[model samples]
Target chain A: MNWKTVLRLVSVDVKSGRLIRGQRLRRYRERRLFQYLLYGGACVLGIVIGLGAGTLYTAVPDPDLRTLFYEGARLLFLSFPIMVLIYSLIFTMMSQIQRMGVRSSIQLPYWLPITWEEHTLASTLAHLIGVPLASIILFGSAIATVSIYLEAVPLAILTIFALVASAFLASTTTEIFRVLQARLIGAVYKSSGRAAVWVRFLGSLLFLIAFYVAWFALTSGGGSIALIEMVASAQQAGWFVPYVWLGMALASFMNGLLAQTIIFSLASLLFILVLFYVAVKLNAKFGLYEPPAITVSRGAYVPKVGFLGRLGFSSLEAAVIRKDFKAFTRRRELMYVFIMPLVFILMPLMQYSGIYGTPVTPGSSRFLSAWILLAPGAIMAVMLGTIIIGEEGGSVWLFFSSPITARSLVKCKYAFVIIFSCIVTLVCGAIGILIARPSPDIAVVLLIESMLLIFALGAVSLGTGIKGADFTEVPRPRMVRPLTVLVYGLLCLVLALAIFSPLLLHAVAMEYIPLPVSLPKLDLYVAISISAVIALVVTFVFYKIALKNAEEFLIKAEI
Target chain B: MILGLIKPDSGSVNVVCTKAEDDPVAVKRQVGYVPESPRLYDFLTGLEYLDFVGDIYGLDASEKKARIEEYLEAMELEGREGDMISSYSQGMKQKITLISAFLHKPKLLLLDEPLSSLDPRSARIVKDLLRKLTAQGITTIMSTHVLEIAQAMCDRIAIMYEGRLLALGNMKELRQKARLPGSDLEDIFLKLTGTEDVREVVEALLK
Candidate 1:
């Protein structure tokens, strides 16, 4: 090995590490390493538990382990699309870092008499090294467990082939998204026409919808077929259905059917290799263009409608809000905040209506109502709070050093939360009407439930806003594990219940409860009123604590 | 008629203002500013960027723009900004940070770098901008540096680092307290401070 080449590679890793470490140290201080390890451990634990549960549930007499192996392989195949989405998010974040200058370290070798191709290759290797190792480990565990369960050489070989194909698929998908984003932005800048920009934006939205629809059909239809086969043949088609031909070819080879195995393997390899090559070439060509410079010329001084002005905010608070709004709207990534909430609203409707054809019943309606009211709060709590601090980037000192009090900054953030929450609540109410078409009494229940849900979400969001660390520079990986997701979901559920319990009690008293005993509607009203009063008190108390804690947090922050 | 950031709607003012109508963006092509506080994106590298000033001045294309290497070399920033500006030393960032105000060879320069993080070498380079630009009839309005350096470098210096002007004039004319003759600029500065005992104390501290 050439020592100089090796040292150059080491320097690249050191520079990337130093850049990441400095960011983590400043934003998270000593807690970052612990948090990363905690998240990784959670993921591993979840996988182990899930695998154990699957094993316990197996009921086949003289159960062929091949069935379990096939099931595990299927789960891995299903995880591919999610992995692709995560890879896209990572690539977008990495591009942002490169734009900022973290990638500039690669230029050092350029000045040091190193060839461009070698430097690029080394940099690519270093880049991959920086990506979290969690996914690879997970993939490895999945393959190992599946292989052991089946003790079938064919299934094991096919699983390996699928894993490699998935990686190529993920990389290609990310590149496609990047290219589309770049082209769309370039067109917008070149035209300087709002209509053109809107058209492009809508086109991308439609494309995503079509892609998801196609994906849903394939996965669900394939899953149903596998389920039928499991019932009929006492064989789990798990990963086998997705990699059916590969499995067949592998089985044939194991049974001394070499001609079939060779044909299948060669075709699959050729297809994946061609795609990988094309994606690499496209990425190289697209990455060369510089980001467009947007120039905003000052126009006539138009005193716009002061929304915050009506909220009794000081001039400083209004100014900060305006600044944040301008910054948020300018960046395409931040626009996800507006779009994502609508997605949450649509998810239940899509899953139920698309596959099962089960129209929303009264029971499902209650669940939907709860989701509508609380989903925005949970999203804003994590996504908004985390991003608000992170997006300030290194210019956080501007807020700190300004005459604007920290209280005002925090208040403005809360104001945004409230405004967004109200919008979400209104949308939820509308959806409830469409889904339930309930009596006037039901409408009132929804109104009260929505209010309680908003307050509860507010309290939780305030807590997260104060406690969450900035992860602005940390490229978002698939960091949150299933357990963490489950925990968050359970927390939201508990908050929603606490908020809506009064309404539930009111329904029971009004003889709206199906079982036990009939009671007066007035008694139900009284119960709901008391619950509302308690929720209000709790919200106020949390708001005060949030303000105090947030101030302390900001002061202690490393900005 | 172009909008100006500092324009007063109903007040009379005599300060020269660059309006967008007069190609305000173009005016910034030649202007450089050292803001009261430097704020840069933490993720961007030093040499990988030409700074926001460069972009605002519209040097987006190749050939016309200053090479990142040239600025790094001139600012003596070698390996610093190549990492994120967030990782830079305060003084290092301040030195190499050429605002859009100066990116286009502005005929006028505005600087707030007086007694903060600027080192001697960086300080000297900033001082040279005024001399070089003014030779081409470019005007400079700098918040004063150390009184001695200001005295030596300025043709018409205004001492206003404290947010209010203390004195404004040429060095020779403002040197009334240098009675012993051939007293350097530092002695003139001491005289301007106006108490013999306090001056002696300050002089002793400086020595």
Candidate 2:
């Protein structure tokens, strides 16, 4: 391996996102100081944390309590390696799945004079460098410093070594999985033809959902401690599994089983080497694989007006709407717009589902029902509306050159956002009703509030999107200007509050306010009517703003 | 200015006899523009894209069907039209863009590097089609870097330099203006642009 070349590749991978932001720099050397400063900062923070932990351990006063503390710390130290390995594996896998949703990740520089082993090793290291390495440094420093106070310096040194080895093992395993996924996905695309589109979309969606579910399960209330305990037990129970061998070795070392410790340590090192070799081999085999052309329609072409036309849209308006729908469904990057709403729904649903041991109280259930019924659709509206025009990216010139009026463009985009958001709301609302079983009146109120938010926020986002659409698609597409998106989000928040405040006030008054004087109850209809009126006014005002922006957008095609 | 894609600094613009400010949509309806480096929606199949273009131009379903089919067959993209444009070759994408421009049969064609990425036969077909359409009173304003193409295909050529018209005329008038009586368009163009002495630059590079 050319160590220099591998190091260069690793540096490129590490600083790729930074490079996009620091394009004004003529060379990497110009940013070298900043990189060093960041490294120094992390080291300082880690050392500070280490000193603090050591001091905390030394301060345990009572003899019995100190003994308990020492035992708990020893147990934690024994399991730390396995815990790091699990975290590294989960994070690397999540990053890989996220890359699959984008058009391109940090691509391997194939034209460079680098061996497959070097490239694979560099990638493995780079993927681990971000969160995994930083965390290891911090924890390792803490462990070392605390060990001095506990008078177990040699064991702490061994545990730190095991931790590093476990992290490397996890990274190498992730590298193999990444290569295999590329080959498998390429094979599926080549053979599946039209079904490949949905297959890829649904597959990415599944992985994304799994990542979120795993994350929620692991991080929620005492989940991390529970996970470590489970892993510790599994390490003892499943001694044959190679993954937990590092932790087992440390545990054995603490228990004075020198033979077992030496054997497991040696085996773990060998396993890591084997994993690295397998990852390199897989990369060599499938690193250059390209996905085949996806034929969406193979039959003779038929030019009939689609369902959008039947919904009373003009041919021009219907065409734009249909194209936007196809864009969202077919484009990998745009698929996130669909996936995000599902994720929003899934998060709250998981809490209420009793799957993660989260107790669903009456208040929690009410919040879940309201959130599941309202938030996804409203969020989808804001997201979709803000991105609809900018999602055109380069092809927006088609709208500019075509005989499309600004009114038609706004109507088409607004209609699409409303339609798609409504679909999401209905699906999510159905799920919410089935799960939460809210009363009919509450459900109706939730649905109405959702509709109002969607309409008003959709227009608000549309106006903002048109005003600040950024069509640059290098590195990755930034659909809207950052400032514009911020404004859009803020505007949506204000408008959503305005539209929901009446209902919100009624609920708060009923729930919290004492009624010694017998205050008249504000009827649900009255609140909803007020909200609907506010939404209608906001929609009318923002629709005009959106129309004006569209006119300027069509004429100002320089972007 | 013509398509209202960008506004003029200090002057009015009209296209197909419609003032852009007065009725930009009307002007757009009459004009079919193929931009330089045309950015197509890669997610859509070529057929779907063409259908979209047809619908935008208010073409009836039957007309859209006939025209898209004819264009696909003529461009030798019949079987591949169902594939997403993302998977298409550059030449194939150019053909699709050309087809979309022609689908509506607009009164005027504004083409920028119209023959770029085209196979020779496809280029010949486009050349012949433009000639026929021109004869039928459909004006075509094509921009090209290939001087030979400009010399052969154009009745009147306008040479632009730094956003200013340096020369406007037929071959005879261009030759007369450049004072290169027997020289071709390339020679006249190089001379006009003051970049005719490229041998010195080439020698400097070699050295």
Candidate 3:
């Protein structure tokens, strides 16, 4: 087995993939200022953390400080492996989910006269996926060192060792998952429509729950049972578990138990070797599993049960919208983006639950809840809107070929974003209203505000996306130019303030801000009427402007 | 320019009773284009892509199903319909692209390097399919660098040099015009387009 060749090949492939191309160079240049600012900010923050750590360790005579950092470093070191595993598995799953385009014709690996046992799978798991993940997690490890700087100076190399070990375990775990996926994906796909997706979703959920439970159990020291006792029991129960060996090694080293440390350390190493062997064996198994043939007529289209797909749109627009929705749902990387809006929706409920511990009566809090819902909904709508055409990857020509007017296309994209955002908002609002028990008045107000902003935000973002989109690029920018972003931000801000002018005017009347002129505040009835008019006006103006701008850009694009 | 992906600087394109500038939707509805390297959504399976195309063309549910089934079998893409296009071989991808283009039953079918990656058998099938489609009075335009294929298939061949059509005619007409009746399309193309004699160039390349 030519292990060296496998290692070299994996390294070269991963390194080359990271190399920016001519197309990306332009984008990098465009983001140069922002990149510099971010890097600069990180450096400054690191310096600050370093100085703060030194100050606390040396000057702070408090006993709690000593115990706090000691415990903090202990937890960080122990949970570091779990964090690495979660992140690595999540990313590998995402990449697998996002796999698109023809298989790259780089058949160099196949040409190598070596079997999977030649450390090919190991190198791929460790280098292609593992090395990049380790490199990313390295940044977090460095930041973590700052919090435990007092001890990092003494056990610096050992801490680095543990962090590196985390990366290896992460890759090994991810390789295990990959083998299972490769074997089961075909069967899952054939079982029922979206069976693979459902299985993957459930798998991800279980993993996340396990991760959260482990973290919570490890961190929580309160209640009738202590974390130490629970962990002791688990450790005893899991004597054969591999990861426990690392922890035992660390604990024994801390306690100066040389014999125990050596035993646990050797056990950890032994398990890692076993894991690699299993990974190679599984890769071979994965290679051998051929998917049963799918009859073309029966397998052509699997119509999704999503709400958006059910809304029959213009055939062309519907297809485009459906594709966007499908891409969003199928791509695991997009799971975060989809979940973010829902979390925002639930924020008010969480706050309410915290405050009253029961359903709250209709009051000022209902308006606050409504604002929370709209705020995230607006952001979600805009972010979703901006990607409509840009996220088409290499399929931009589909739009260009359609002969559908740019205005019509943009409008459809805007509508899709609006529809999706509304669905999220409505789900959140219903839950919030159920828990918070807002009055009919507040509910009506929430509905009206959501509808107005959804349309306005959607149009503005779709316009911005179309105007700045470079059709030639693949995996197009998720964001607009920084300068354009500022413009869009200002437009969104103005519309938002106009929508909330009644509240703002009332606040000003109540002397929240000292205005140059003491303008008399109108009644709620009058204020609401005026704001609704302004919202309507803003929505109409933005929609028209966005549509017209999109038309011009589409017509002028050189393709 | 014809598909509105780009704007024309000095000319106009009109096809299928629709002007390119007038209404892109109408023009697109009547034109099925297969670019030299069509950038398909690789994330989609063969069937999904065809279905999407069917929807884009506004095909009725039953009609789309029948057409998709008929072509999938004809193109020999039956068994692998459920696989992601990313997993498809080049020849397989090309077959799927061809199937997608025909789903809409457009009036004008434009093909660029359509047979670039097809197997010999698949190539023959595509040629037959193109012939059948064109015989239905659908205007077919194909662009390829392979002179033999151009000569063998096209009723009227246009030899382009640096974007200019140096000569345009049927096989007999072009041969007569080029004063190379015994030569194939390559010689006639070279003579009319004023390309230098290639005997020495070919020998040098071999060496």
Candidate 4:
């Protein structure tokens, strides 16, 4: 429709990630240069590598070896389109998932005088420009440059065209699916009514699981190259499938089957056009639609002190804890935070279950079990700790205006992180125990280490979050400053390692090291005791820091 | 600064008898504030949100419930209090914000555009409620763009232009200061703010 409008919209989406760099550096020219640098650098690297390979290829004067090189290169080039298509499809779809929130990557200006087709096309093109575009440019440059020496420039040209077309095909398909996902989620919410919160959570969790499952299945065995080879073989047998048509077209062209190439290319073109048409229509129908409000509760005007008092929290602290819990469970944007740790835990468990073709050996099993027991809870602690205060976003004024002391703020937030982390640890440890059957002593060690890391890292991140919470919600919500997150993650890693080192050394000493006759034996419990003390000291120090930061944050409300 | 929502840059700040810098929480305890644009927790139902705020202010269970229910009914939001605030319209959200400011019954109220997004009935109710609260010894500091509301509702009005107070007094005193003794509050405000050349700006724009 409106080419100028579409390009303008696409530019915004392309540079959306840079919007979180803070308010002062909102200059468009700088962002545009940065965006260009990514792709341009990739292209340059690709070309340099191609030139080196081309020079080496020409120097290999042996006819048979050269012939083999040509054959391998031909196979790779033929399959490149389908490979790009799958990558483009999966990445674009994953990006689309994040865009499902109220503040999507590009907030479509629905109130503006732009048509649906223009908006849909702009989104599709924008999604393509990041990973998918970089990929095509890199591979396309290398293949096209190397083709000069291979004496197959025409075929490389054809393959490149097919690659670009397939990327569009995948992106347009993702656009359709994105709109469909919104419509389906809305429908489910409407029909479920009172149970909307639970239904939406489980439904989205299942969807996320299915997406990962399909992704792992596709890239499981020998990775993308193997998958590409499989797809290349399958293309011939499954020529009727339109997804593989672009690859088949290139294959046909390489085999000197001009007629077949024309037919397959035309079919591929038609399929993409049809997908585009359907996507545009879907966008027109539901792009501007708002989902119905989810009703979690009804018919109540009662306030209770609740069971949090039993846990020794003040009313103010308990109220904040309950509110944060509801926010996590009920808010769609926050649901991802809850599901991510579960998914991280599930992945290894799936491997242990032999679902991913990895049988659990006793050695591997113990390590996996330890990982399951220790990692997810600590990771969740760190993540939730950093995001807890920042998740208040614009609503932070409530804390400022209320009579909440800094100590109460830190105490409540820290308590929530600890409680949630403990729950995750127990759940994951239980599953790991069921699957791996780790020895009781090791299980105790794992659990203790997990709890210690959670306590220590939770305080560290909470302190970091308080100091550097980013309340920017436009485009999308950025909980903490990127630099702060980086430093916090590094510090957590170092702290976790320090806490785990004594126990790890004990394990190593007992299992492998010869006992020095001069040294006294180190007991397992002794090492765990040392770790617990270290964790407590770290927690206490950081908890105090978090309190200080909270005081400053409370006083500096943007109100 | 009075509510301790922000730290004062140069001046010493006090709320009630507490110095804000020394004890912001104590200062906050004595003050209830509704910002210009209320950014509320949309995930919680209105009742849950109000309850949370009540608890934060250390309201007992029965008192919190009674106050929340009374305010909801007063604001015509009784039936809808159970719905998540994300589901509420702008007016409903503004009403909830107003009720939150009033829920704890602090000694002082700081409201910015308190009647914004309110229906006429809700606005009237809030105006009457504010007057009642004032009579009962609760101090109100309200800021609004509507001069009529300020002229009608305020005991002492402060006319601010560009973050500086241009004038401060009751209506009669302000009328005298502007030297337009018979003029309405709008003209007096314009004259005091030195933006009385409204005709010239409009004429330039038309040309």
Candidate 5:
């Protein structure tokens, strides 16, 4: 087989896909930023830990520092495989699915002169090329640092082999999962019925629950003990048990055992080759194919009664809300936005109930409740605003030229935001009350806090909505990066600090002034009322600006 | 009576003295719309999408089942229906869009670019579909850039370039009034619309 030609063709195809997705330029910038952040964070963390260790425990000598470095390197090496496997698999599959969809790929072998096996092999190799290289570089650097401290050649060699095996294992597992998922989806589609869809969803949920339970059980003390012993026994038998075997082989090699080093390297290489072969065969059989066809019935239009219907919502608005609610209920990604707030509310309540060792204080309860309500409120606002504007995509002209005015459109979007935020906040607040069993005063405080956070989130949403660019045409999934998340988190923190500054100042004064004099209830009530009024006014002002910004965006888009 | 986005209140929009506003959803079911720019869920294949629209229009289960294969073949997209709509080329998407609008045989078929991106083969298929429907006495309103297609295909043509209808008439009368004897439809269209600049641009690109 002409491997070079296959490689060239693969490269050309990869490059073309990258160009189509506008990824070549964006990916370059992303890579540079990622490297900068990773290295920078690592250096800062290392320095902080080193300094803390030096100050707190000075009994350890230079040998201890060397040992700590080796341990850190080993942990990083062990974890790298799993991280690369999950991230590379998910990112590659999602990006490919979004870009060309499953149908296009299914036609690839038929259109091209190459066999399915060859095409699958080339594509798999092309997909793994980036992540594999990254993994190697990361582990290679870590090994080099360790070598400088310990002068161990065998450790460096073994580390490189282990990482390569990890990358292969990750890539293969990902391919298998993708194939399985596509086939399952296809089967569900062929059997068209409401029952089929529900069965599929329930099956997936059950599988997820089972997997998590198994994982928890496996990691628990009883399971871990048995598993560890089993692995130790396997390592003594031979060098094929992966983690334990590799650990033993590497330890032997580090002690200058040449035979073990050579044997370990050969076994690792054979494992990767065999895995790749099997993965290629699987891809040929099932990988390149159309997604399963599922029939969707037009949802019955039930007239929404009560508060939402009375909000002057038009038919289109009601339809959109109903449709979105149904869609989000089915979507796992959106479920997280709902789930996170519940976690925020429940975690503190759990602590208060003495489920976790700590007894929660009143101040802690207030902080937790406020955070639980605020974080999710901000996320929901951002998500709704971004998607509403962005979903227009290449079809903005239809919306613009429609008889519907921009004002009505904006109003509908805001109505969705407000309604969703209120629902989430109220549910979370109810949970908080159930847990804390706070006095009526605390209930009132919770109400005020909820209102304040909602208004603030409304303003934040408008601001971000205006500034954020729509990437609808781009193939990559919409993801808020860790840094952007941190920034948003910091903004929330600053706002919370500003609101509770009076309480903080009161606490400080109590330490100095020596009196147990609490602020009047009336004064606290007035303060909260003023803050709510100011937040509402700001929200209104931002809403106006956001509306204008949206109009300008629509005009500019001209889609 | 249902009113607001689907129907307007304070007035009767009647079909044979049965006010459509009395059952706006039923009215909407009978009114087919091909949006200016159609967006289908990329996750669905062409046949599945057509079946969905058919089901929504309250077609019976047996009818929907029968119609899926019929429309797919009618649209000249029978074999390709298994492929996702997102995988279809521009012309293919246009064909599916047309098929979706016509699935339930609506009384009023609103079409935008019913033939725009189609190749001659697919365009002819769509033209035949339009002819077959209108022969069954269903009214069809469609927009097109190909004046020749309109002249040949449409009984009545509405010339709308910039959100305004410049002319509305039968083919022969409009062509005759333009004072171009024996000139084909393209020449007459160029003269009426004064799109000489566009012709020049096309000529330059060809050159």
Candidate 6:
């Protein structure tokens, strides 16, 4: 074994890691105002939340119950480090699925004069920053929380060891996920519409269930009944639930069972090493293998398509929407973004389902209905702006050089966003009304507001995308910088308030209409009509502004 | 600019009767461009990408379907529509781009290093295709560093160095201008581009 070469490769990984961080810091530093605003806001918010949490804790009057709750909170806090490790595995695996493996644009090292082993090792080592960083933060926080209620240094040491083992396991399994992601994409991407749709839906549904399960376990915010139920589910997770051993070790430490703690700790270490060996073997078999060229004959099953769209896109604009829709559908990873808003909207329905036997009203929370509309509207808007340009990857030059006008280009993307967002909002709105049964006037007002939100959201998202678009990207890099998201969000918030202002006035005016406006239904109809007119006017104005800005920006766009 | 994509800081571009600045949309419609390494939408199927371009060109339903299928078959891509363009080989992408550029049947065609990914047979097919299009009165301008291909294929050649045109002419005119009658295109290009003694560089490399 060339230990020297391995060490050299390791050093290069360290240097490259440092270089990447340095560049990021430098870029952030370049935008000093935005960076300062973001960091400053976060720090202030942290301080405020900490003070409030402290106040809430001390304000509890029931001493016995409070003590019991303190123990529960300590146990929960102690579970965080272990939870972090598990999450690291889950999230890393999901993101790796987003990657195209050896065919990835980032695979520049494939062309370098390096051995497969060295390349894999260096690339793997380079990513060591993420797991370690998460481990340290969670370890420190867990220790701090537990230290407040108990004094167990030995338990702390065991917890640290378990964390290291978990991190090691997570890091090594990176290539495993890469292979899984690649194979999954290959199978689904090659299939026709029906197969693709099923795979996309199934993938998103699994993640949603997993997300809910994890969230329920961590929060159990519903009550002791929910907590007991979560514990039962955890017990039912079967024999391979080794992750629970971390908690078991902590529980043993809390109860002063040294033997069990020692055993669990040793077993965890052993498991980590076994996983490392398996991971290395998997990496050799999969990650180290070079990707073959895309052979024309391999794809010998071209699917026929309709000449015209189902949504009546007869002109040049249809082409843009068709391409965008196709790209969006083909990349199943992106489907989660599309599915997630509906998931959120369905939350109350799921919560109030017959299983709970809870009394539910569909339109009970007008604010929630508004939130449902805005959340999905926001996602679609940001997607429209960022995705339309970003998904173009390198191929965007085709559109840029085409006979298509900038106005029409912007219009086409916005039209898709409008169509997609409106359909989803209406469906969710109907469901919300059916379940919650809010007043007809409020629902009508919300429908109008939903349309306004779509227009405003698109404008904000497109503007942000135009500012920071890097066209030569695939699944394009974050089109809106974090600061840009905040800025655009604030901008959209203003637009929302402005658009809803007229509707709000109408809603408040319901209580004290003059004698001449005696009929309640007539007044409600008048209010809805006025608001609808206002929404129409606002949408037209914002759409024009957004189009003008986008046209100017695109005309000057370098790539 | 004649490219229609980038605006010229000074001067103007005129393609056919219309100045590019006057109506860039019209100029874009008139011109067919095939960039050397065109970025393709990886998420669309090969057939979908064709239909997309055909729709933009405003081709009728039957015409679009017929032409798209014909070209896909011509390019041996008829069977590849099930897969996303993301899964397509570089040559396949090049073929599709070429087909899109040709499908429009514009007044002018601009192709840049069009045969980079093609095998010999496909390259020959492209040469014949270009000849056919040019014969159909569609003015085709191709930029390639391959001297033999440029000499053999192009009706007129433009040699550019550092973003400035060094020479523009027919094969005979360029030969006369370079004072290298009966000499190869490589020599003429080298003379025009101001590169010195390539034989020495070749010798050094061999050594």
Report the C-alpha lDDT of model 5 over A58-119, residue by residue, as the tens digit: 45568778577556545444444444444455545544444432133446666667665566
Q: Where is model 3 chain B poorest over a 10-residue stretch in terms of lDDT?
A: B1-10
Q: Cα lDDT for residue A287, model 6? A: 51
Top-down DockQ ranking = 4, 2, 3, 6, 5, 1
- Model 5 spans with C-alpha error above 4 angstroms: A1-106, A125-135, A188-192, A195-252, A255-260, A298-308, A330-369, A392-397, A430-444, A466-474, A477-522, B1-37, B41-112, B116-151, B154-207
lDDT of 2 by residue, B9-88 (tens): 78888777888877889999999899999989888888989999999999999989999999999999988988888779
TM-score of 3: 0.76
Question: Sorted on TM-score, highest at the top, how do the candidates line up?
Answer: 4, 2, 6, 3, 5, 1
Q: Which has the better DockQ: candidate 2, or candidate 6?
A: 2
Query: Which regions of candidate 4 fall more than 4 Å away from where they truly are?
Result: A14-18, A25-32, A55-65, A103-111, A215-221, A349-360, A512-521
DockQ of each: 0.06, 0.73, 0.38, 0.73, 0.08, 0.37
CAPRI docking class of candidate 4: medium
For residues B25-108, write the lDDT of model 5, one tens digit per residue: 445555566766676645455665565455445465566667666766666876677555655778778777777677677776
lDDT of 2 by residue, A1-559 (tens): 8898889988877766553342444543555666556456666786786677668777878888878878877888878888888788988876665455344433464766678888888999987876788777777887887788788898999989988898898899888888788788778887988898899778877876776777777777667888877877788998899998899899899899999999999999999988899888777777775546788998877777678788889999998888888888877667777777778777777666776677888888888889889999999999998888877877788888899999999999999999999999999999889988999989988998998889999999999888878766654566787877886788789889989888877786687333345445677789899999999999999999999998888877754
Q: After superposition, how far is residue A520 of candidate 6 from its true place, in Å?
A: 15
RMSD of each: 13.1, 3.7, 6.3, 2.8, 9.6, 6.2
Question: Which number leads on lDDT?
Answer: 4
Q: lDDT at B194 for candidate 3? A: 81
Tens-digit per-residue lDDT, A1-559, candidate 4: 8899999988877666665656555354564566588799889988997899889889998999988878888988878888888889988887767555543422355678888788888988988977789989999899889999898999989988998999999999888888887788779887887898889778777777777766765666545666767877888999888998999999899889999999999999999989998998888777766656777667655567589999899999999999999888877667777666667766766656665467777767767878889988999999999999888988988888888889899999999999999999999899878877888988988998999999999999999989879877655677889899998889999999999988877866776334343334568889899999999999999999999998888888753
Question: Which predicted model would earn the best DockQ?
Answer: 4
> Residue B162: error of model 3 in Å?
6.9
Q: C-alpha displacement of A338 in model 1, angstroms?
A: 2.4
Which candidate should be chosen as best, given TM-score against the real structure?
4
Error of 4 at A539 (Å): 1.4
In candidate 5 the C-alpha lDDT for residue A328 amounts to 48
Quantify how close model 6 is to the true structure by its C-alpha RMSD in Å: 6.2
